[model samples]
Target: MPELPEAETIARALAGILPGRVIRSVTVLREDVVAGSAPQFGAALRGKRFSEVGRRGKNVVLVLEDATRVVVNLGMTGRLVPGPGPGVPPASTHPAVLFHLDGGACVAYDDVRRFGRLRQLSRAEWTRWSRQLGPEPLSRSFTGRRMRGILSGSRAPVRSLLLDQRRIAGTGNIYAVEALWSARIHPRAPSNQIGDAGAVRLHRALRRVLRAAVGAGGTTLRNYRAPNGNEGLFQRRLHAYGREGRPCHRCRTPIERVVFGGRSAFFCPRCQPC
Candidate 1:
């Protein structure tokens, strides 16, 4: 699934290409990908014009002319591609939704696993959903004090806490691992045990990692791509996410890979002492 950086990259790409484009029609090839009835989804979007594009946590929002929001979650293996008008793009072998623009271009939502979603939410629904998320990690609200406040509770693995959407929205295994390594903290460290120094280090590391990932177009270890259909370059810069058994980037110890909370965690035993 695309996390904050991935979703943000796609949203920024869409912001560049989608403004002023009017939706002439919508084709829903898979009803499962539509949040509600396909007919209703089509009716809500048809003839609407895109105003802006934004991201909330891991979801992308396409703001429409009448304040309706087309929320998209690219659950693993989903890609959004734009092309010339009149037909679906050629790479849409598994197209789930197609948005036909009035100018003849089209944006295709292709998901191979059928796990992606497209939903139209009214202002109220949008507000409700947005309220459920934690502060954006890249925002000013996620300060060191704020991070420590969220971490000042019951025991949970620091990595696990970072993965909690309600605790630190948009961090997943990849950024969590990288951030922990950058902060020199262990994956299994207790969240509540982090001191002021550790918390401050972690807060800064998280912001740096997320910003760098977005700069690299987001890690594309799988089917992730920008709206322009370009693969991410961040994977080349990874330190701990998938470097298991390799030399630690900062220490000589071999990087260790373990399963924590059912997800693969990579860390250097020496650098990130536990």
Candidate 2:
């Protein structure tokens, strides 16, 4: 589950390798892995030079010389890495698509579950889709007051609200669980009932955890790694996520797990009281 931190790490890695590299050819290994006609997708990107690489929420943004934006939503188990060449075996694993660059370097897109998608969009299309997502949590505009407003009208569980991309972008299950735990808030607490102080605490915790994770190259629980094939070190510093039976670092209370909305949330029962 590559959340904002994972996506940010990938975008940073790509930024170092992709920009100014001209695409000589594109090979789509799995037709279903991409949106629309895979052939057309490849043709559109061929001969285009990468102008920039960045992230919007949890998606990786690739800006091309022609102003076409290639957005990759690495749903669940997707990865993008720069490799040697198409003829050479990938350093990490086989790829779904390969973008052969001018100097024999290549960029590979790999997704084990095939849930991720690669889409080519015009500037107008990118702007429209981006507007539909909530504010980037790491942005300066996403203040505690803004977070309170987002939760004030919702009756959904706080954890669910955190996972809602339309309500708060870039947070998936892992970061949501960690943020809630860090704030000492119960996952089942009603969003509208969290009050202003609690919202501020949650907001601060979210930003802290996300920044720390990004600095550490994101968490690599499984099937996640930087483009350089280095696993994230943040997973070792996690406080609550995936620590159901483990002791809480802050409190000696055993961490607990609960399932709702088809996802599991981990927390410390005593520290995050209902």
Clashes, model 2: 0
- Which tens-of-lDDT digit does each residue in 1-274 have in candidate 2? 7899999999998998889999999999988888899999999988999999999899999999888999999988899977755456456464788888887887789888888999999889999998989999999999999999999989999999998889988999989999999999999999999999999999999999999999999999889988888999999989999998999999889999999999999999899998
For each candidate, give its TM-score against the true structure: 0.96, 0.97
Q: How accurate locally, in lDDT, is each candidate? A: 0.89, 0.91
Give candidate 1's total backbone clashes.
2
How much is 76 displaced in model 1, in angstroms? 0.7
lDDT of 2 at 179: 93
Please state the error at residue 38 of candidate 1 in Å: 1.2
Model 1 lDDT per residue over 1-274, tens place: 7888999999998899899999999999999999979999998899999999999888889999899999998888777888844554636768889898976888989899999888899999999988988889999778899999888873899999999988878888899999999999999999999888999999999999999999999999978878766899999999998998899878678999989799998999998889
